[model samples]
Target: MLGLDKKDFTLLLIVSALVLLAPLLLNPFPEGSAMAQFNAGYPDLMQRFVIFGIFAIGFNILFGLTGYLSFGHAAFLGAGSYAGMWMLKLLSMNVIPAIIFSTLIAGAISFLIGWISLRRSGIYFSILTLAFAQMAFVLAASVLTPITGGETGLQPALSDPRILPEFLGGGSVTADGNIPKPSLFGIEMTASSEVAVGNWLWTLNWGYYLSGFMMLVAFYIAIRIFRSPFGLMLKAVKSNQQRMSYTGLNTRPYMLACFVISGMYAGLAGGLMAAMDPQVGAERMQWTASGEVVLMTILGGVGTLIGPVLGAGLIKYFENIFSKINKATLEVWFGVFPDWMTDLMVTIVYPFIGKGWHLTLGLMFMAVVIFLPGGLVEGGQKIAKLFSRKKEPETPGGEAKPAE
Candidate 1:
């Protein structure tokens, strides 16, 4: 109805429903249960899900549409965070200005980087982006100490000249001794209230809802882009760039535009991060951080619109659950079994949890790559197809039952 095709609009509805119901769906285990650890309905983790979903969505725009795989998207994210943090420190504690500043600054940086890197294609392009990211990380950590706060990272302090906020009859000072938290107008993002129904507790945090609202907006933008003629050109670039070039189309601008847009998305995600936590660290620009978003996109379904969001949530949920499983939790899980069986089972599964969550992630990624390279969305499609085949087709007179 809103210029979206039936399937695309349907997909949007499904995503909207899932996101809206996530607080209840994710915390189904209740307050006191053996499976409570698996519940990921908390505010912070939910924020991460939406933020990373935005990151993966942006990444998919470039990688899925234009076939340009970046190994350094985290640089834009870090740049955005730093920019947002500086805005918070210098101007005001309101998150709106900070996020806006982050998106604009990150877009400019990505434009410059894309202009330089688009000269090369394939692995050379990936390597150039990686080199730029590593340089950013190094400079933030060492050479740019005065600006970036070096190893300590950039943080809001009490001594900054917040001219705008002070003139507005408000400041970062709080009634408590601690530094002020990030806010929207006068409403603090970190402020939250809880809803309780019986043993179930749901946290409704302002930051989470704000992030979720941004996610919906981002998703809508992605849908629009995916349906546009520009998206067709990007797909053409991916399918056959030589033909596009021969047709007198300057593919460089299209590729560069995709890169900058994706980078700006990353920056927006990073700004949300700063808005929630008010902290910016150099580790955010690390190569590993960049790789995680790549994994999110591939593991979700690289080309699909909703796949990246699902993938980001899946990865984040697994990371949250697996990292919390310690020896003690394993013992509690195996308490029903005999001593020897329990010990053996715990011994086998122990390495894949806690600090070993990486092992679990690696195994999961391998399985998805090997069996379902199309990712979770493809797997879901296959399952649906199988179920549909099992349903009996109706005869002219009556519904036909499956043969015994």
Candidate 2:
């Protein structure tokens, strides 16, 4: 089915179903209701979920399979954003062209960076990549101000000469005094169709679906890579480079290839973000952003094909939840508790939310590292197996019988 073995095909089906149903699942409250604050079914967050999923999935290709931990991958992401923004600024508002440009630019830059960095292994390689990324970050902020829009970042301009879409005003401005929006052949990405049934209102946006579709494609490609002979070589590289050297197989090219591919993935994600929001900030290239993707991959379970996606969604969702929580929101949820209890709960939880959300994320990472280095997926599987074992029938000799 779908050119995949049974297990792979089933996994694909499950992921597809989840992606398609996300809007409904994420939005469980009515639009006008007070609880709507908790609903993340909106287009912006939905787009982020899938976009970051693509980023995580790509990073997984390199770090998970080959164990080449690049601390500078976010530089590629920022580079892609700039490329996408340029395409919009110079070429057209059509997302297709922007996405293509993003992929190509990121891949070229990554190829160069990988060529230089792959010369060293272990911590040395990590440092080289980090240094390159820091240089790019500094350039983007200061010396390259004219090109990168400086600290203010790149935003669609009123003066851009959109050569292709001559009749239409460039992005950030539409012809009829309407705010400009990214589109595909004039179909606006921000456009949405809202269906209200009872108290629930589901918003299906062009941008979210497009991002989700791209994520699906990326995920499929990752599945193929994981099953390929090249993927086996990456695993071998991770397991023992010395053994591979003994086999007379050069691993540098393979490592470079993995780095380039993963960099392209980051670029794709950054381009999508620019297309959706019509802005590209140098902040996207920060080392912290690179660290976040690594955290997402490890939190969800590194080396497992679906782990990165799960981790991205989980982290992003929690980030949103944490950012939105405030004293008022906490009060609403804890209203039933006594005053002292509510106050105590609020005190305990307040530090984890809002500006202190990073503390929460760090604690979660530490817990995952200490308790289950295999990550959440392994922990979940263990719990499931434990439950299954407990549910099994015991035989006459006090041995457990196989579950029927």
Candidate 3:
């Protein structure tokens, strides 16, 4: 029954409020605000935030708690996506079965991988996982062409089999029977509807809400794992495996369990991504995608409970927003400055902002690691402490108290 303490409860309340109000807050620029372009309430971007948040949270369970840096996590995610898609193609478009089967399959795959990879520790374990992930990527690209759809990616089509609703009137088959999109109850899970006010437009899609709800559930589970006794054992293993072994605790099973759990989380995220978008690409299993999750987890704060969420949001923001900037937009912003200064600035910054957004992200990540090793959460804590220090002298205990 390990659970949140009072402080943790307060934090959870705050985060819940934020999540609930995110759409409103993100869309409050009056449609013409200078920063309106940066607003994150759009269905696609918001979905990504929650999806990657799940990814980072899952990665945190392994690397943050058990001190195991897995370089092959993307494989589970890709596998889960493919599995979920196959379910959609072969069975009914109900998400429950797809998500469950995807998670279980990913867990099984992780168990096999962990059994082999756990034999090595440190860099060796990392390399083994990397090798495995690369192999998966290659196989998906070639050997698994039928299932994975090869280089063009797996997409929804009319050729899929629909085994549900066998008692249709006269057993008549409809065009919608094949390649059906997943639904909740009877509601379609596809993105639909657009709200436009003056020149501003916002899409209220079912996929966004579905993904958001899933992310909230994922966050709750992560919090539970962080506060659980099992989590403590994993942390102990991370700190000192030899000492844990000396205490008669078998660390291997714990580590393996953690690895499988983490893989399942990644798989869940991948499944949701496919469900929302109805496509699965081989690139999702690439080493670069795995590295992105590692960066998200480390950039936010490795061990802190909420840091991974923050990291996921930040990285995803940059990925979606910054990468969309281009030279034409730069010229528009530079209109405020002198021609020479504007030209100079754009020339210096253009490469890093548009297609080179990754370079900017890399530099910012390095800066965070160098200056705030505890991640953005530590910086926030420091700011809170600074404000609290300023107000403390006004309290009844203004006089210095003796140390215990």
Candidate 4:
């Protein structure tokens, strides 16, 4: 297939199918049904799934392959986001320029940070990254207030100059004098169409498809990197960087390169987010945001292709569906039960839903770490093995042989 071995090719096909059909797959429950609350086929949520999938995929490159657990990758994401926002404000509403400039700026920032941070390894390196991220957050919120818009964040306004439109022989302002939304050529990012299939409604979103396409490309690149010789070197670095250093192998450049690449990935995700929403906030660079990617990679299966995407979807699903289960929703779900019984059920389950969704996530993370250290992928493999039938040995007559 696409230069990949049969297994990798099959995996790629499966992912493509999933991404293409996500609106249908994520909306299995019929509209207005009780279970519809769990449906995540909406444009906003779908975009988040693929965008964060890209983030986790990039984080996995450095953490999974090179054993560099960054605690500040979100800085790159934030930087890219600001860059994208600037492009949107000063250039045109078209998302292409913003995305490209976002990537390049983030890569450059990563290169500088990696050059300094890669000097140390282990917890020290992790601490340095965290410090850098926190510094960026503070700077964005305070010192860089003029550029970042401080606590309010940066967003486009109709009054601002957009030179690209003028250069292209068009007015930047619409006839209605509204701030333009991000778009691809003539298509708006928020544009969507709906199809009704019986009681089910599916939303086909331009932004989601665009983000999904980017995610697929990012995934393919990650797969190639994983299977490449450079990927092999990264794995070797993970196994024994100190030994490689003793052997006169300059591991620093490899680590720095991986770090910059990972940062660029984060930046791209941030740019996509801005293109969708056209806003950039300092909060995007917080250490917690960086930690979330780490959790996504670990929960899905670090170093394994497709694990980060799976993990990202799971977490996003939890954030959207589980967190939305309020008392009213829970009551509706348990309406068939007796009043007292329904109340009891809600009381017991309430803590794990709504505001306490993180508790559920924490418990799940703990269970996976304890029981399935290889993450959800290992559990899936185990289930697959259990369902698979073992072939018995055959005799020369082509009949099953009896056990000796």
Candidate 5:
């Protein structure tokens, strides 16, 4: 069976439980507690962590398994977001159809791009994909203004027309002259708040939970793909393309399949983002976003099942949380030191730690590349080995051996 061993399976379950319960644990401190500032229980950020986790996992399947480094993945993700938003505008707010349609659209787009890009391998393929993505970004920004909403971006408005229940007061009456945001069944998905620890705080509302649930589903699907026979075939293509060709196997179709599948995953993540926020912008498909996914996969640990999730969490943490910390906050922390020391420390570390969180991330990436080329997972394994070594038995020859 293509599955984890007992220990690994148990570990996965424990991790899943921990993730699911994170909000409660993180929010346990009272509102006025000093540690409350560090709490990360908000639904929006948690949802993003998982949503991007799915994105990174999908990217890893292509880059990690096939050795194909795509620099245009955000094209598919942005495409999916647009497709899903259109569905919300035209049809019911149910996420099922939105996700399905978005995935299909993303797969179709990826297929076309892959067909052309796969004609060349190595840097040529990367350049082809990059060019296509840049074209997409520009088109979304300009030519498709009517559909894409141009620079201001597309957002949910009550002006949108709904087809069903028009005569029964359930459909497009234009009463308020504003299009209502999409909803699941009858539950509205706008931003909302809740009281936690006697403090009023913003929660994910319905849309965030819906997005989180979809992320979990995406994660499960990715896990299945990682264990599937098709995945094995893709890995084979990655490992020895020449050998596979000599064995009469056509590798192009397999590579294309992998590319499409990965694109669909990116699309799913994009769809969820749109579903939660009901907005689509050209910037989402930019090459920088595509490079972000690459960073996520490499930093987390390519080829390992859970590494993408770790990488996604790490990057998202930096993007959302760390970037929000500014020089003023540093000044507050450094106020405890002598005047000269405070000024010196703030001047020295401010550039990299505050708004320049990306600089720190870059340094981290370089360190990982230099010392732990396999990424964080390899570092974790090395730590585990170090701890386990002490328990190992010494053989008669003075070499370490199994304890038993």
Candidate 6:
């Protein structure tokens, strides 16, 4: 189905189901409930979930399959965001053109960077990419102040001329003199519909749906690439680039292509981010931003099709949900206990949440690395294996039967 084998097609369906049903899945608690604070069905965090998922998915193509760990991939994301912002400012408030331009610009930048960085493999290449990213960051933050808005950042302005809207028979400026929000034709990205079921509330966001759709497409494409000869070549490069070189095979082109494709994915993610918020900052290109995606990929399960998406979702959940758990919130949860007990409980768990969520993430990462090197996916597989082993029937000689 959809050019995918049974397992891959099943995986695709599962992902699709998850993305489409995330609102319900992420919001299991009733509205106004104490646990409702952990609900992630809101548009902002949901959008981040998919946007970063796309970013990590792209990074996995390079780092996961090809063994090329880029320490500066966020440069492409930041570049794409800037490009998208420019599109919003100069062109119509439509997101399509901005997204297209973002991908193209990021691809071009990645091409230039890859052309130079791919010359050296391993740590040398990583350092080169990092240096270029740092240079880009500095330029965007300072040297390119006029264009990037310097430290002030870039966002839509009320007075700027949006030529496309004028040609489309609409005035660019709002009658209220407010900046226009990004949209698909007339549907604003911030627009959403809400449905109330009993005590539960669900928000269906247009922007999130759009981003989710793009993520689905991106995932499908990644699956195709992973199953193709190109993906095998990338795996080979990871396994032994020197061997392929000895066989007179030119591998630089493949590496560059993979790098550009990955950048395009990151670019699309950045573009969607701008479409949702219509803002750009030089901080988007920081090395920490790049490292975050690497961590997402590694934590989710690098080299596996669905691993990065899981990782991205996990990290975003920690960032959004766990980080929001404060003393007051914890006090409320433990309110039923004695005052001393509540205070003690808060003290015990305080360090892992509310401004120290990174500690929890670090601990989880360490556990994954030391125990399950394959990430959460491997952990899941091990659990499944255990259950399956228990389910197997015993043979006549008191041994488990091995049946096909």
Q: Which regions of candidate 6 fall more than 4 Å away from where they truly are?
A: 166-171, 334-342, 392-404
Question: Could you give the candidate ranking by lDDT, starting with the highest?
Answer: 6, 4, 2, 1, 3, 5
When 3 and 4 are scored with TM-score, the better candidate is 4
Better of 3 and 5 by lDDT: 3
Q: Candidate 2: TM-score?
A: 0.93
| Candidate 5 structure quality by residue, lDDT tens digits, 111-161 | 999999988888888889999999999999999999889888987666565
lDDT (Cα, tens digit) per residue for candidate 3, span 54-80: 889999999999888999999999998
Residue by residue across 158-237, what tens digits does model 1's lDDT show? 88655574433136576675677788877789888889999999888888888888898899999999999999999999
TM-score per model over all chains: 0.93, 0.93, 0.89, 0.93, 0.88, 0.94
Candidate-wise lDDT, in order: 0.87, 0.88, 0.81, 0.89, 0.78, 0.91
Best by lDDT: 6
Give model 6's TM-score versus the native structure.
0.94
281 in model 6: Cα distance from truth in Å? Answer: 0.9
Using TM-score as the measure, name the better of candidate 1 and candidate 2.
1
Error of 4 at 283 (Å): 0.9
Q: Write the per-residue lDDT of candidate 2 for residues 324-369, one digit (tens) a residue.
A: 7788888888889999999999898888887788887888888888
Q: Order of candidates by TM-score, top first? A: 6, 1, 4, 2, 3, 5
Q: Candidate 5, overall lDDT?
A: 0.78
| Root-mean-square deviation (CA) per prediction | 4.8, 4.5, 5.6, 5.9, 5.5, 4.6
| Candidate 2 lDDT score relative to the true structure | 0.88
RMSD of 1: 4.8
- Checking candidate 3 for backbone clashes, the offending pairs are none
Candidate 6 per-residue C-alpha lDDT over 1-404 given as tens digits, one digit per residue, 9 for 90 to 100: 99999999999999999999998899999999978989999999999999999999999999988999899999999999999988888888889889999999999999999999999989998999999999999999999998888888999887767788544313467767777788888788999999999999999999999999999999999999999999999999999999999999999999999999999999999899988998899999999999899889989999999999999998999899889989999998889999999999999999989899998888888878787778888877766676677765552332222110
Worst lDDT run of 10 residues, candidate 2, spans: 395-404
